[model samples]
Target: MKKLNFTSITKYTILFLIALLLTVTAIVFLEGRKSKNISLWITPASYFNEGWYYFDSDSRRQEIDSLPVRIPADKFGTARIYHKMVRSSHYCMYIDYYAHHQAVKAFFNDELIFEYAPPSNPGWLKSYRSFHNLIAIPLNRDGILCIETKASISSTAGEFGQIRIGSRDELLNRIVSERLPQFLLGAVLIVLGFILFIITAFYLRVAFDRTILYFTLLLIFLGVWQTEESRLLQFFIGFQALHWFFEYMMQPFILILSFLFIKELFINKKHPALIILFACITLSIFTQLILQITGIAQMTSTLFMINSMFIVVFAYILVLINLNFEFARKSVKVIFSISIALCIVSFIISSAVKHHKNFTDPILYLGIVFLFISISIFVIQKTQKQFNAVRSAEIYKKLAFLDISTGVSNQTAWYTLIENFSADGIKLDKYCMFMFDMNNLKTINDQYGHLEGDKAIRSFCECLKRAVGKSGDIYRIGGDEFICLCKNIDYTRATQIENMFDYYVKNQTESKVQFTAAHGYAFFSPSSKADFIQAQSMADKAMYENKILSKKGRS
Candidate 1:
């Protein structure tokens, strides 16, 4: 790895430059748009941000047409509409606007003109009117037109947004132009989420990355949240109040997944506080869910505050982890530092805004994008480490079973194989065990040093391997001692192979010193439960007896 300080500085510089470029570009984009006055017709909705008869709570609205504009888009509650008679000599007045998770009532000069169904009404939920619905409020009022609206969630700043009071055709055009940006970006995010989901599902191996999986889930929820909040889902699918479910549920989803992501990222750290915080968040979500489902409580006010606290708490944890250095790498520290700072700034800006109609702060979304990139880098690095560790373990395991001198199975492998066969509750059939002992290994070692003796042993083992080939398994038990377990081989073939081994020992010039091995074989017919070990013992005793016979013949 590069020096931590230099790598950290370099990464910070690049990230800062990228953020700067994006920020400047955003500023330029915002600067390009000229603010239009309320009286203009180019964008009529831009004129009606405030300045109308508005109330969040239940109260009788008075009919009166006020001035041009009053409230900003970020302030709470419905699109306030008052009487604005068209100067046309023939055309009747009609108002067009967008309604969010809210219902409205309009009064014409203190007379009940119309009462919009509340979002809680099943009829409202079943309406084909999307949140992007350009609701047309027809007015036959000569005196005044009064509108009052409220949202389901008390914590939500505004119930309805993008209010426009004008001719139907002009407001329709404005609707299209204003909603285009939200739809495009929402679609892009949804597609990006789907792609990430596929990558998390398919490319992972035996030992998978949980962090990436969780992060992918986070992306998916983020996309859903953005899409629903953008009112595009309504425009596309005609899902009216259903967006409220997504809007409410997404915070808990993000919170849970983020907790899991952080946990997976810091495997080495044991933070009891993190665990406790996760538990509290989980409990809060479940309790709120139960209450919302049972009609015991509304999810708007309390859960909103809880979600806000979760963000702050999670940010604080990230900062503390990064600062400790014991819990975080330099790259991770840099990422978290940027993340915490961004979170704070975004939170402040969002809170300071008077009318926050957007789904989320754009600054927070930017942080989310960078956090994802950093996490991906960490996952790739962590996965490589896991792969290397697995490879090392396999190499070590192979080394434990190998005989360095003979390149065959060592005694450890021999014992392990027996234990496995026994544990598996299986019996061997048509099996033969051959036991062999070198005739003069001690004499050869004494006369020609240990290296020559080792050479003789290797040559004998190599010659035996050639004769046996794939017909059996061989084990180097001890110095000058060996065993071969030949499966599926009849007695005759085992004898022939054994004789071939003896011939190679006597005539093969590969060994520096002439040598022979006294060998004996035991065969088992059909099958026997204890056959494997019994055959080995019998073969060993027969080999020693044969050794005595060979010494007598030599004498």
Candidate 2:
């Protein structure tokens, strides 16, 4: 029967217990805070979507059956949307909507109430993509609500989104809840990126792979871009410029970093196609920034071009992967290819939805998340492979230098240690060399068996190890002989170790085989190979003399 390793079992048991305790605690905390009344927590808002009238720039009025009245893309001018307000007594009534690439003014009963991005501003200043608006309705009054909108961009003229009316707090809560997942996911990715960056930097000496750094950067940029896309930050910081800058700036770098990350998985580091793509994307980013800064063009105006570049690069990467399929790692070939393909499909879908509905879609973000997961899998696989290789190398190294029977350093290790010291010209200052010879090993083997002799040898080694402790290294140089080398030890310490060895050998009771050994030690300060050999010879001679004396006493 095999003996059980109680120490390992106990260690695992403790870890499992700790994990269970933490899980239970978390469950209890979550259950305690869980809300029972879901309806009360989430108040449904009413949509003021139907029965609206729209008047175009040509003074032509049209009765719209529903909200989100879309004007012609070729038309670039002011438009008016009219709807009758219904006062609600049960809630603090407010109307909330989104304005996209347009300036908006709200009037209640011919009185100006709320306005954003007045027509007096320059075209550049009014070029913000989207902003949310909330207007409170006066109590005890019923009047017609008119929203006047102006769009300088022809593509976005007269685009009105869904208008919702409800309690102010409920509407705000609903909006936040809708965007919270994307915001949290982005924040989590950013935090995870920072954590990975710190870990890679801390273990930079041991970790040779640069892919982790690239992947971390990619995560951070993806996070920033996703958060910006969520529009949750707009609620906290009203400045649209900051959000626009990050959203556009992070997109280009995300592409570059993703390319670099994929590039690292391949055997060939420098692929011409990838380099060209990288340079082109970088140039486009710089050009966009310069144009936007100079007021020659807005970043929003060039968004379609950037998105087109993304599609081109994504498709090109698929082709590139096909061309270099044989060069990439197996993990990369399967995971990266599928992830990129899925991302491309999702990007197309998301673009279509955004173009159709004039609103942000979550499909692209989901695809990005999937891509991140795949990249993480690839990195983990690579790291695991490297770890296994290093572990195998270390195991092989230990086997080469270890004695099978005695579990001590073998003769080869001793020779190697001496050669290393000699080659490095290291002086053995105040070093003690102890030699040990087992007694009655041949008698035991001849009378009982070699198995008993092996047991005796192991027993002798165990006692020697106990005596030596951490002060010296023990080596099994021969079948019945051993050597212990101690650094920075004097004659007095050598005598103490010798006494300890005898005491341990006499008191050893684990093995049924009777075991004894004769040992002798010599001090030396050798600076050369010859000097080390002379010192070893002296210790051996002293061990032989002690062996003979021990035999005579037994006689």
Candidate 3:
């Protein structure tokens, strides 16, 4: 109702937290009532014993959530397990283990289904003793799938293990867990971002802090890319090609966000590194696209490795910039660190799952939450900093032009305005100027003290300011003298303004501090080399004539 009121960091933080809480609640509510026809089961490390039958545990373990097993260096041995499948259509089994070679044999209710060896390189921390297995076992009826693992007899000084299992819809769930929530979160951010854009567009006309507005928009685009990649939405919506396209396409958004975020946060205007980074991102995307289309394994491998390394390197660069800029406060830094950590964790989980089967990780959504909060903190801090800087500048500017006592333009500011007019040259062909000297200010000060005389001067200035409207500038050039310059105006407007001031002063019945003002007008050509002093002299003479007339009237 109050248009978000994001003037303070606290208000913006509160809004972000509320939005996050609402999103989580909605996701949970949406997931709670689902009735999808898919087999759901958990496969822990010790699911079978003695290679004969499968068993269910009475208790659940924390490590069983996504099947991250730790195998010690000494206990290197083989394990045989028999798993009975109740009913199978199109089924997938995912196994994540910390081993090199875990040979698997599958059996279906006394009949052998298949026997195969898990890939030697499951792509889990390459050269480390970690492997993941995804086996798809299709069948027409309910049967038993036995898994007998034979450890490498020649293994020396390292852990050898592999996770083995088989199920229906495990692949879909794994893929969904990796990409769905992230995609949806991205869509939400994009929509909300445009809404913020609309608000910013409206405020920019009157707003002094343009930096905050620009950085906020950059963060919104970052949110979009994080969502698209994390949710694998490209794959779901656009097929395999879409997935491949997104893998490269998402790179540009990341590069752009990093460059813009760092630039805005640090106030760096001419950093060539940012341009280079964008070009690199563009090149990488093109290379990746070509590699995916042509299916060049060598090129693909080289590019993937390079991209992954760049991610780590660029993230480190961001950290360096964050440290150097000091743009983020302590609270903001903590939030950013946590979010970055979660993002790294999400990437690790996604990469690990791509090699394994059955086990699914829920880190994508968690990472989304962290990234959003981090970006929110950065954005809020940046906005507040910029707003404070601009407001301080405005305050200084106001002080520069204003007379402290009279609350009107001072001599210094009057000269500054004249200089500006000098730069532009005179455009108007006709104008009015008025110069006034308060009558007997020295006598008034001696009789009634300086304070009373000062009050009279301030009152006159206030009246002149009110009567001047938008056509004139009022300047207190001296203690007793003031000048009012009105451009693109004639004697008629000046007379009207003078008459209004005189009427207001006459109607005041409380005070007897009588005041009088004199004014002058001229119609000089733009080509004439008339300085402000010449105009002031003409106005001063005209004022003297008016004053003599007033004195004669009083006599």
Candidate 4:
């Protein structure tokens, strides 16, 4: 029942600031000790069978030597060595220096099955230094194979920091020191999301209407997806399979959150655009599921493109909704812009990694972090606004029902009251009705002013409202006339209400303009009573008689 203490932005900013501080402090203090850059000494044959591999990182020399292992020639159609190398330990700085960018050419009796970096022109790393490639090896009729790496680079050695390999035994050490920081940060973010979900669930009874349940579920899903352990599912099922599943699942959830978040933000739910967006998302999800089950990976690119388009469109709608509100508009713009930027970055990273097996760098995950943070903030801001709007609406509804001048039920609300108390019978239970008129109201308006007459009415209604208390209804149906109706009346309670009105008048003033109210009542058994109409007519006449008696006494 208290007013909102701060603006929407102030409240939401505090929330995100606290979360950010905790995350940053924990990461810096707990895991800040620097980790050595690990050399990835893995090879394709490493997965085929188990073997030992040597990883060497000298001043400018990066080498990976895997012991002899059986190459699977029956499957994968012409097996080859894929060279994927990335500099580790340095974040926020582009280190794309390839000291020696050549693959160790594999051969079967000198018959070349494939070549790794097909003879590039000089100065390829004029901008940066990194190398990733796949070198092929031929097989004899006896399933025998030979594999080796050949390297040629400038004599000028470059200062390099770290190296990682994906050969035989090193396969278990999938994530290295540099990668752990990012994965850990992701874990923290996911945990924060879960905490938020728990907080929301606590107030679930108050806030969980039909609409909010959808968003609550979404937050839970997001929390689970961003966890470090969730990513470990990749080890059980291959990375490619996990990648495909995630890409397909993200579209539908994004659409649901978009609609729910926007509705909460603006506090308006009548937008027609939401239906169309949902239809598109549902269709896309269904289409993607079918394509995935059909064992077709080539169509994934096209599916991704279409899905990305829908996401962009959904974010654009959010931008439009946010533009109307001054405080939220800027935040919305920031969120949408970041989303688009992240989508583009991820697309580029994925394509680069696909064409050249450079999966070591952390571009996609970085974008994901930014995207989650921005969207989470936006969702929280929206929820707060929705809460305030609903609260204000209830206040306004109560205000509308009562007469501000009389502090009693207005004529507009009296019928609704009758419907609530009415019984199912030809005639309702015994009741008493009191009608009141201020004596010489026209004279008072002529002598003093309408304002003075208005004060008398307000004062009388206050007395009436207080006296009615828990057992009766009072109405300001006319300018100077009022009605009090009591159901199943005991005259003792009735006399108290009437006496309280008289006491209020007697204590106020003894002037000529002293106001008094005429009272009347009618009681009957349901079988004998005619109806509300006939009963009210008798009460009206009785009240008139009392008014005449009061006038005579005053004279």
Q: Which candidate wins on TM-score?
A: 2
How many angstroms is residue 68 displaced in model 3 relative to the true structure, after the best TM-score fit? Answer: 22
The all-Cα superposition gives candidate 1 an RMSD in Å to the true structure of: 11.3
Model 1, 478: alpha-carbon shift in Å? 1.1
RMSD (Cα, Å) for all candidates, in order, is 11.3, 7.8, 13.4, 15.0
TM-score of 3: 0.57
Pairs clashing in candidate 3? Answer: 92-167, 94-357, 94-358, 99-161, 107-146, 179-231
| lDDT pick, better of 3 and 4 | 3
Rank order (by lDDT, best first): 2, 1, 3, 4
TM-score against native, each model: 0.57, 0.68, 0.57, 0.50
**Model 2 Cα lDDT, one tens digit per residue, 59-81:** 77778878777854334567778
Name the candidate that leads on lDDT: 2
Quote model 4's TM-score: 0.50
lDDT of 3 by residue, 1-555 (tens): 555454776877989999999999999879977966455533322332223332224232222222233222224444434444556454544443223444545555766555655344323311111123345554556766555555533232222233434342444455455456667777777776676666545653226344445445655765555554564453446343343334444455555555555555444556576556556666766665465445443232434543453455346544744666465457657667767767766655645564343343355456546555655666566556655776788889999988999888899998787566632455545656777766677887888888888887877777777778788888999997888877777667878888876776556433357666555444443343356767777878877887788779879
Error of 2 at 537 (Å): 11
Cα lDDT of all candidates, in order?
Answer: 0.65, 0.77, 0.57, 0.52
lDDT of 2: 0.77
- Residue 543 of model 1 has an lDDT of 93
lDDT: which is higher, 2 or 3? 2
Better lDDT candidate (1, 3): 1
| Model 2: how far residue 283 lies from native, Å | 3.0
